[model samples]
Target: RDRGGRGDRGDRGGHRGGGHAALLPPGRTPGGTQHAAKEGRASLRVSGVHGPEAGLNGIYLPTDVESHDFSCWHQNDSFYKVWLCRGPRAFWIFQPASQRGTAQGFMISKERHLERPQDATTWRLWRDGGWKVFSTIHVREASPKDVDSDAARGRAPPKKPP
Candidate 1:
């Protein structure tokens, strides 16, 4: 289970407040959320259990395993913040602990105002006795003018032009 900030009160576009408080890096908060006064300080606790169907412990559908609560904080320095839970466990499908590796049933913060394309990030859960980061895909925002130009051009630009 998980608990953190509340969802945005208005139609301000997917912004939330008073929920899972992740640690901030130095002078930055992720997605403009309030940062903690100290570094590496988690404003909220994240914990959950993974079932056998999660493919953990070599079991196709093992019983639910309880997970320890992890301290999270907000950091604006990076486009996103990541937290990994060591050991074979499952996190809450909703709220703060949004799965992002190879597992199913994960949720992202409503306050995360960035618009992401499909497959931009893949959530995975491994059972090698600890939480491991399988992969991460970062999506950068395109400027309004760039988007307009791309639309006019009728095609996306190459990853890296020669």
Candidate 2:
């Protein structure tokens, strides 16, 4: 069953939201705790201890920043549960759960979700062609050096980095 309180139908129903409720718990992350809004669009701030797989984790934002899809967004302008599967190399398995009937085969599936990237820094999020990367930024207090550098370059410092 999905977080929506229904059995998985495999793509024969309407688009659903709140898919990440099962994967992510409220106010929990690797470095600290932060809460995602329950009813509005928000960013999923991913953080983890930098290790041999340092590049494996980072911030994942929806293709539409304003999109209510707080989970993974598909190129077709829908949200999906992007499963990162381990193989010789890591890959994605996104079989969107339907709400009405069984339709599990990928051939009949309409949504083309995020495909694997050549490297950890990018992902193919669009069909026509556009690759996006997980944000390497973690929210923290900026030092005076950062402000000075921005001013020297004639660029205004961001009120907040997203």
TM-score, one value per model: 0.17, 0.20
Q: Candidate 1 on 43-109: residue-level lDDT in tens?
A: 2222222443221111011011122322222211111223222111222222222321212222332
Q: State the C-alpha lDDT per candidate.
A: 0.25, 0.25
User: In model 2, which regions exceed 4 Å deviation?
Assistant: 1-39, 64-162
The worst-scoring run of ten residues by lDDT in candidate 1 lies at 55-64
For 38-67, candidate 2 gives per-residue lDDT tens digits of 354222332332433233232332332111
lDDT of 1 at 81: 29
Residue runs of model 1 more than 4 Å from their true location after superposition:
1-26, 33-43, 51-106, 109-162
| lDDT score for residue 85 of model 1 | 23
